[model samples]
Target: MSLSRLVQRLRHAALCAAVGLMAAVPAAHAQSDADAGAFPAKPLRFIVPYPPGGPLDLMARALGEKVRASLGQPVIIENRAGAGGNIGADVAAKAAPDGYTLVMGAVATHAINPWLYASLPYDPIKDFAPITLVAAVPNVLVMNKEFAQANGIASVADLIAYGKRHPGRLNYGSGGNGSAGHLAGELLKARAGLDALHVPYQGAAPAQLALLSGQSDFMFDNLAAAAPLIRDGKVQALAVTTLARSSLLADVPTIDESGVPGFDLGTWFGVFATGGTPEPVVQKLNQAYVQALRQPDIVDRLRVMGSQAQPLSAQDFARMVAAEKEKYREIVKLSGASIN
Candidate 1:
């Protein structure tokens, strides 16, 4: 037993530690590769941040069914409806970035909520990896048939003229204070320089009922929900709240074309994964959702529901979201819409 024997023992121990560390590095890399290849090895949680039976929920279920066939995994729809879709969006934002969790993000969640909410739980642009846009539904300017007839408001121009003449007399009803319908009404007021009272109901159905019962003068109603009422001569359709006319309401003009220049708004929703999801997985999700959107049945169903499915690539979708968010920032500020 000497100093030389002790030094040899130390050297042998150091070499063994180095060998073990090298082996562990390779094993870690192998595990990572395996995980990368197993994209969506289990069911995916598809969050629809609204209540069931709505367009977003129905479309999510349809897309989930279609994608399940191709991805070989079930897409579970999780409706987390509250705080104007912020709760569900926050859930998806904080979820693991393994591409298994996705949220059906909408204009409200990604664009409007960021600006409306006093403190948002997540950054819409930074916290999500865009998959693809699912659908866009146009809002229609509909008035009670009796109100329009009695007031001589046969078109958007007439309504604007009457509103300007009557000032605070013409009132509009919406789903809620900060809802898209309310915002649309506010935008209309701003654009046309008309003064109208905003009457907010607990939900769109209630707002539409107010309009139908003549409790409210008019409303910015979802075209899908108002289409039947309009067809039945219960409500009079004036114009759609989109730059482009809705195919379902072929004869109707857009607010942009109805004397309110530069006016455009719609309900648009899409899919988004956790921000740090791998690029390949994002692309795969885009393809799957876009494919589902392009299906003949899906296309027809959306058309019937007054929604248009125009899917875009993931990069393009991201750009669209960014642009829309900026657009809504100004709109929300102008509307003075806020949430605590």
Candidate 2:
């Protein structure tokens, strides 16, 4: 072979290697542009699936403050309360998969509704992308101070005694059928051998209203939603519906520790974007909320409202959602609660 020919062959090999390297590394400009425009271009919408003062709503507002500071965009809170969070969840699920839209979802919307409804509109796992879980707030057994004082019902024991004494006479109100509140009441009846009638209302706010109006005897309300009312002496806290005591209500005993021995049930809130949102967008969202949940003030505030922040990665959140769905399936079946 001639020397010039060999030099030409080496030149060809060098050109091929250069092309391969360019292909292996994506274009720098494309990557930089994506990084710059990942998220936070405009104001983001945060939909709360319940009334304004509920635990899910409180978490959305609290986390929104920290997330806006980090993401450099205003976070707007929209209240779409109805059908035990189904109305808002359906709206969020159908929103564009763009990262600008997100919903503060609850166990009732994602896990229990599908099991309870015969023809549910949205598919929880298929229609949303899991972001971090904001917190797990337990249910607190609450009654109007007026009724409690009149009846001398001071604690869980007293409430249980009254319930057993009057089977169909005792009534409890919940957000709606198949809601965490409703299921919690059923669980209480099953465990404590009480014959309490289940009263379903439009939302937690109205259910609480019914309790205060003396339309209902007692209720299991989210601790955060009942916090202000409880603090204001509008309602009395009998017991928290978790096996372990709630940090926010340290003075309140767990239902398990009360008379029921092993009563454990509660609700959790998590952030979710429309399914099919870009993976990078989802990651950015998870990072923002998780970071906010870790902040000292945010963490402390949530805990104070009975929303104990539980930050989780996207994968972990997805796994947790699946497990929660399965767990609630049996609960719904046993309770025989359904909507539409």
Candidate 3:
């Protein structure tokens, strides 16, 4: 062959090889996308970082049922309770990014606890891929009926004024140091300028029991847990910890309006998979949750529990988590709350 022709043929062969390699890349990527789209081909494990019957656990079960129906797979609930929900969250964070394992992440695990603890086993923001924010539940300020009646505290203003006059004589209970209830109480103290003592319990149930038994003067409780008690007259609803009044307790005023202006704290629950999960799988989960939230029966059920569905895209949810982390960092600084 002529030298020029030989060189041209070699160059053409190299060009063809490069084109073939580039073509194969997309084919592989497309196959991967197809596999991700066919996700949950088997059973899915939904991890709840708390014991059964709690708000997180109950919400997980409810959502799991709907997810199972939508995906045509069994959504199993696995309770791995401990370390203020860090244990199970760590498990989920380190899990395989196959979309089969999911965690029902709460504000404690996703936002608050990360800053509260001196060292966490997993990175709250980077360790997991956010699916969607399923729901938000506000905290209600409640006092034991007997305690309120005895102290003549009929309203939130009355309670605040009384706390100021008594200074430290009043105490409020919460699930634990970094819990939403505890943070709500601290926010109230800072905004309302009241000097009430903080009493921490192992969980919300014990905290509510302490309030009911008059062991604590007041408590900031999840509306789901405290609403029924307030309706039963076992506790007095002072106010809710949100910017606006809750529809479930329309008669009750918000802490911002009641006395503490600009005071708002609430808890949210969402689903998350391990980091590096495919975008298509995350989109699928978000779509399923958004659809579930739109169901009339699901809406009514969540409303009765003093919660409302809130669905967000993966990017939006990630931004929400970052904002929450910064917000709580300021809160922790102001409140001087540290787990270590």
Candidate 4:
């Protein structure tokens, strides 16, 4: 063959090989799209940082039902409560990044624990991928009605003033050290300039019991846990810890406006998957949660529990976590709260 003809044939072969490779690329891309579209083909396990019968557990179960219905797969709730919520959070953070395991993370586990614990098993900000901020539950300052009346505590402002005048004489109960209730009380103490001692319990129910029995002067509890008692006149709600008045407790003023300026703390729950989950999967989970939050039944249940349905995008949730981390770092410093 002529040299020019030989060269032409060789170039044509190379061109044909390149064309074949290019044709296979779309087939691979299509397979990936197919896999991403068929997410949650199996059951999903959602880990709650608290045990059953608590606010976080209740919220998880409620939301999990909707997620199951929406995804057409079973969404199971796994409780791994301990270490001020660090144990369960660490489990979720270290879970497989395949979107099968998620965690219902709370303010304590996600925002405060990092600053409170000297050596966390997982990085709060980096170890897990944030899916969405599912809901927000305002913390209520409740005192046993009879106890409050006996102590002549009628209003939140009065309680703070009295506690200041009689420093170290008053003590408040919390779910546990560095829990949301604990941080809320600490924020109150720091803002009100009061010397009230803290009494941490295993959970809010116990804390409420302590307040009822007059073992503690007052208790900071999730509105869900305190609302029924407050309504039945068992406990007198002095104020809510949110910056704005909660619709569930419109009559109760916010602590920020009640005497302690800039006092804002509330327990929040969100969903997160392990880091390295595919972006498409994260988007799918976020959309599912947003839909679940809008369901009428879920909305009613959350509202009755004194929690509001709030949803945010994955990026927005990440930014929210970062902001909370910064805020709580300052709070942990001011409150001198450390797990180690």
lDDT (C-alpha) at residue 4 in model 1: 21
- Residue-wise lDDT of candidate 1 within 248-320, one digit each (tens)? 9999998888898878788888899999998868877887888899999999989998876777778767877
Give the TM-scores of the predictions, in the order they appear.
0.89, 0.78, 0.86, 0.86
Q: Give the Cα error of residue 86 in candidate 3, in Å.
A: 0.5
Model 3, residue pairs in steric clash: none
Where in model 4 is the C-alpha error above 4 Å?
Answer: 1-35
Candidate 1 vs candidate 2, TM-score winner: 1
Worst window of 10 by summed lDDT in candidate 1: 1-10
Q: What is the lDDT of residue 233 in candidate 3?
A: 88
Count steric clashes of candidate 3: 0
- All candidates: CA RMSD in angstroms? 15.4, 13.8, 13.3, 14.1
Candidate 2: lDDT of 46? 92
Q: Scored by CA lDDT, what does every candidate get? A: 0.87, 0.82, 0.82, 0.81
* Candidate 2: regions farther than 4 A off: 1-37, 40-43, 51-55, 144-153, 228-235
* Model 3 CA deviation exceeding 4 Å by range: 1-37
lDDT of 2 at 166: 72
Q: Which candidate is the best by TM-score?
A: 1
Best by lDDT: 1
For model 4, the local distance difference test gives 0.81
- Please give the lDDT score for candidate 2: 0.82
Which of the two, 1 or 2, has more lDDT?
Answer: 1
